[model samples]
Target: MHGTALSGWLLVAVCTATGAYCLLRLRSDCARARSSAGGEAVMGFGMAAMAVPAAFAEPPSWLLAGYAGVFAAAALRAGWLARARENGGGHHLHHVIGSLAMVYMALAMSAPGGHTAHEGHPGAAGGVPLVTGALLVYYVGYVLTTGARLLPAAVTPRGGGTLAWRARPELTLACRLSMGIAMLAMLLAL
Candidate 1:
């Protein structure tokens, strides 16, 4: 593969690995709480929504269709969680926003005239600007919100003093930063 292609695959690999870590962490939390697997599953699905595009960079038409299906499912789950009376465990709104960002990346990859599409062409001036701007905003929001939630969790003690370090806080921050950088890279690539 060419350098660009290699870089693309690397991006996919990073995203999928991080997403997997997040899924496992949530699963462990579920196990600890003795709760149903529903919440963990939903979060896993959201992370999977992100991994789909990354894992299938030059996917066949059917693969893209599958990506669309997963994204739809993720969106439904996010909406349901949003309407819940009390959000719990993870940061519901922030995850929803991050999920939406993944949706944007997937859509951008599949959209007509996008760089990755078969019949791709340069987008209209305004179109590229609008989409890229929105994506940047989305990642920034993801970073800020996830960071805010993580600060306390990483610092607060469970019984009396905080743990040395918290995985969720660290991972959440890393994900946010990487996503923001990825968004910038995408904009520059455009």
Candidate 2:
């Protein structure tokens, strides 16, 4: 019921900063994955960019514009990369899903008064808040799965365990943790 301007701006700032950090961390990981897996880093950057404007701007229109633009660009870029894959690899599916979820959350958040046909209806969807919650779930899952994939790569791998516990895991953890925090912010907005 409360939609304070300060809170809204704060939400945008937090999400943007965290998302930017994640993208930087992902850049390093993508460099390492380049020889083996080419596009995940770029795709991750695309996802990070999608959330940036939403996180920094107040009101849905400005945020949504950035969100829509980034999402569209990502979809196109992803499609082009997919076409070039010998194995038709879709490694960036996590980024794709995460980005889509962020855009969804942005849309719902930007909705006027958080009101829609579903608002206050018993059997209705509970409007924007419900959609935001669903998006949070998807974002969380995407972060978890991507984290799991990065974990093994980061481990030093000695006798089926990590050793030295090098930089990759640290960077990967940074990316995943930032993403988790961003998603939590979205949840708070609801």
Candidate 3:
């Protein structure tokens, strides 16, 4: 969701591309990579759908409710995965937060007197301003941290050949950073 149609379309494209790349990451041999990629794929596609310009199609209330329900379930699943004694539990924990934020945003949009009128203004949605602000802060910090992690580093590449890019950790980090920035934009629109 954005003020302008062009920005909305851009967001959708970014998210869709990120989702497609994450789907490619599913071929990774590492279980943790596959699992995290699965969750990220869902988030990417979901964000794309939600970012559709209201001018083209204003989703019905029931659909918004469905979004809330689906993301809630995803949040629960992520919470469970986060508790497991796995090396990538941190990634699952981040997914939990991201899913819950999506749920919150969907609910906010579905609520009466929500973003129906002020489609692009911050705090226009029906959620508590503090909560929205908190999510915005979290996503901003996530974007910054992920972006920093993407800085040039001296290290041997793990994967090789034509298919190697699909499993590159740097690519995954870049994908996460893009999504984090998109999330920030969505929250600001809210």
1-190 in candidate 2: lDDT tens per residue?
1235565455445545544544444434334343212233333443344334333444446755676566656655555555555634354554455556555554554566432235465322123556666766776776777677676654454467543312345554555555555555545444
lDDT of 1: 0.49
The global C-alpha lDDT for each of the candidates, from Candidate 1 onward, is 0.49, 0.49, 0.86
* Least accurate 10 contiguous residues by lDDT in model 1: 31-40
Winning model by lDDT: 3
RMSD of each: 5.5, 6.5, 2.6
Residues 1-190 of candidate 1 have per-residue lDDT tens digits of 1126556555556655555555555544433322212433443444434333333455454655565566566666756666654554244454455455555555555555443423344452123577668767866675577567556644444576543322344654565555545544544443
Q: Which of the two candidates, 1 or 3, achieves a greater lDDT against the reference? A: 3
Best by TM-score: 3
Instruction: In model 2, state the lDDT of residue 81.
Output: 57
Instruction: State the displacement of the C-alpha of residue 156, model 3, in Å, after optimal TM-score superposition.
Output: 3.1
TM-score of each: 0.61, 0.52, 0.91
TM-score-better candidate, 1 vs 2: 1
Question: Looking at candidate 3, what is the lDDT of residue 42?
Answer: 93
